[model samples]
Target chain A: MTATQLSPGRVRKTPAGAAAPGRRRAFDRYLNPVLGAVGVAVVLASWQICASTGVVDPKFSSSPSGAFGALVDSFKSGDVWSPLGSTLSIVAWGMVISIVAAIPLGLLIGRNRVLYALTDPLISIMYSVPYVVFLPMLIFWFGIGADARVVIVVWSALFPLLINVIAGARNLEQSHLQVSRVFCASRLMTLRSVAFPATLPYILAGVRQAVGRALIGAIVAELFMGSAGLGYVVQLKTSNFQTDDAMAAIAVIAVIAVLLNHGVAYLEQRLTFWSRTD
Target chain B: MNDPRRKLVVDDLRIGHWSRRSGTFALACDGLTFDVAENAFVAIVGPSGCGKTTFLTALAGLIPVESGRLELNGEQISGPSRDRSLVFQQASLFPWRNVVANIEFGLKAQGRLDAEGRARVAELVELVGLSGKEDKYPRELSGGMSQRVNLARALATDPDLLLLDEPFSALDAQTRELMQEELTRVWQADSAGSGKTAVFVTHDVPEAVFLADRVIVLSSGPAHLVEVVEVNLPRPRGPEVKRSPEFQEISDYILSLVMSQNKPGRRTEDHDSNAALSR
Candidate 1:
């Protein structure tokens, strides 16, 4: 209302000593990208030199330029979509199932001492052990179908999310719960409004972990049992000695992984912005 | 919601908690008997770790009465009810919510965030001197600002009784003093200017004297009734009221009572006894 006082949430709009950080801010903003680009360029230049100079067989070790050309070729020929779509769909479905099932189940288990006791050892084992060891059994049960692929993805993704949600729920602040109790909130209201929001930072953290695991699960499934997907494409092309195409598919996987990670990180920042100390 | 005869009764009250670690009962308040009349501002004071906080908490229906009659309007409090709200010692605000949303939490929780409820919330935001700061998140607020939000959230519900547990204890000296005055103003201004029943629990002798119609003193841990010192200070009081001789006399008396309860060698002197001697 007053000219002197800016609106709420805008209190931090102008930091004191603003004149000082100008150069530092500019340096911080551009330094990372510029350095990253140079690092990448050097690696590509070295790889190209090795391949063209016959230091390594191009058939076995594809050059960065060759991979890029093969990538462009695959996209233009419309041969990239089917595998890409398959892998993405499996990851999406797995994430959906993990999120839906884990949050409620985690909260329920976390809140109840008896249930938490019953499941703690089981969950710890599942989360700590490599999911790859279970792949053979899952394929035996579900038979390399899309169902098996989705199940594998969920298997890899679900435990991390569940663990995080449970930890978050268990760590609910006593004071916050007291506020809810004093207000006479209904059980459902307490769960939805209090417990859920209090646990949001943890939930987002879990989601970040789950997304990475989900991608790994999808790729591993495709590599071993998938007749479709970029992972399968990479495997098949490598066997055929078309290393350039194989490297191109691997490059696509790397891009997907990076994009997915960045997307989750962005979401975490937006959703749990309040939790950040800085 | 108004009943002229509405009152809180605590007759020979006992409160305790069962600690599973030791598998034994830890008594908090033992046979503490006192009653707060309709719309009276009552303060309970004692040494640190005394059961003042526990007693106030029991009155809010957060902890069950182990025995004796602890009733509001002649009904026993079995659990936390909508009739009372507590201003916690720490400003336990939800960080995700802005000041306005945090103030609106109680109303929203009780499914009472209708038009009138929103209006009251807006009024409380102003009452607590947090008008322009309404959109600031908890992380964005200072210690004093967040406590204002905490007070507003409690007041927004318009409960029959309000319980405060040393709400200003965490603030710095100057801010605490300023807030104490703000509290007196807000307490009288809100609830249609009638000032609803308030039970404030604090270890601050001066604070207890400055605010309450009656200051109930409790002895250290497993607290029992020590003395019920009624403050006969005039209405519409301010910080200047604390400078009055009557305020000094009363606060000194209460302070001596509290200091006496502690082990004889524990404190050198926590009060201005020179003023007491001069008086």
Candidate 2:
């Protein structure tokens, strides 16, 4: 055989090879987490520096180390566990109630023109009203037990889920519905196959927003009227001048919110695997 | 699959739509009367506003008919049924389902997606030249590939009649031509020996002549059935046959018919001109 025939340079590289650099940069999977970590580190370092230098009063603001020390002390004393468990359970049940009530109602209003017309104005009016403003009245009617707390939580979180699910169902493509019809799909079959999957992404987006509202609801109800839960602990510690403990509880709340948001976002990404974000 | 000999009969059919903008019910297709023999490839060709799509959808039972009798295999069609499958202008593959699952959709709907049914879907995936792409999603496919999946999904149910409404109109010229050839092969592929019948709608004249056994031309307004021209070209025809004089003549004839229908009140123009000159 000739030397030219065996030479590695004789074979041309594919266009994909030439395009590899830009393509690799376009979707470097590590870029997001690395940048996120950098951003979080910068925020924490600045806050720590401000607290240690007395740029902000450490007594009121509490330094990062002070809050971390308080967190460790609360864990050892077993004061954080019961409150945390109670808050988690209440928020979980409230979300469950809201989802069950809202999904069916949203579907009904979304699919039917007459039903949508009838309910849309009322929904708008209710949504515009600040649900947090009703806490005092709720405590008056139901008393400051789990009932009132759960009601407040559900009330705050329901609208986002309802509105999003309605938009998702209403905006379902006519062509997709027509595909089911061409196959002679029944109404139930069409709902199960086409409408459900189409609404999932929107529902997940709603849930992401609802998580923040639910956390706020739990905090507000517990801090203002209830005698238990993490919000109560934060309020008690703050009023008693235990600023570090209050800051630590608030930090935990922030962490919980972040975790819940990320969890739903991950679920959305997995379910809508066919969608192209870029 | 139930009776490959099923025929479609439309008698005095009228299709009307309520125009929300105009607040009027405009008749789209009026007094449309025709019969499609079993296993015949029929193409409906006309101008843009000719309601060819309306006619196809009416046959599919998507729209309610104003007045007429429509029958398939001597049975009345009041609603959409698996007996007649439709291929849309856009592929309309479910974005959430992968290629194999998209093809399996109809089978699942019919509750026939057993082990054998899955095997049939695999065969269809191969038949459409998408064997290696069985797990790929619709967004990952090119326009032609997606339409192939659409065609396979329609055939998966083994419907007696296939309704196509400009299925390749969205494709580019080169891809459209290749898809047309692929479609002809898939339709004629008698591996299962179903002998599926089809009714296609398009505004493209050459496409009508090339892929059809008979081309049905319609008038511009209200889309009255203007003429039905038989395409007696030999079978196994390819892009090479497009260069043949016979194919060109047939294409020219259909184009002229469409052009004549498109021009309104042309026959009375001379009389109006003579009167104006005398005045």
RMSD of each: 6.6, 9.8
Poorest 10 consecutive residues by lDDT, candidate 2 chain A: A1-10
Q: Where does candidate 1 stray beyond 4 Å?
A: A1-17, A21-24, B1-6, B20-23, B191-193, B264-279
* C-alpha local distance difference test of each model: 0.85, 0.81
- Please provide, for model 2 over B1-279, each residue's C-alpha lDDT reduced to its tens digit, 9 standing for 90 to 100: 234333888778888777655667766688887778888899999876667787787788888778887789887778789888889877988888999988998888878899988888889999999989988988889999999999999888888889998999999999999988888888888466545678999989999898999999987747678888999998777888788999999999999999888676423222221121111
Clash-forming residue pairs, model 1: none
Worst 10 residues of 2 chain B by lDDT: B270-279
Q: Please provide TM-scores computed only on chain A for all of the candidate models, following their numbering.
A: 0.93, 0.85
TM-score of 2: 0.89
Per-residue lDDT over A163-261 for candidate 1, one digit per residue giving the tens place of the 0 to 100 score? 998888888877788888889898899999988887777787788889999999999999999999988999899999999999999999999999998
Instruction: Please provide, for model 2 over A1-278, each residue's C-alpha lDDT reduced to its tens digit, 9 standing for 90 to 100.
Output: 00111111112223455557876755665677899999988988998999999899988888889999999998999888888888888899889998898887787788889999998888877678988779788988989998889999998999888887788788787778888888877788788888877777677777777777988999999999878888998999889888899988988888888898778777776776565433
Q: How close is every model to the real structure, measured as TM-score?
A: 0.93, 0.89
- Candidate 1 DockQ score? 0.48
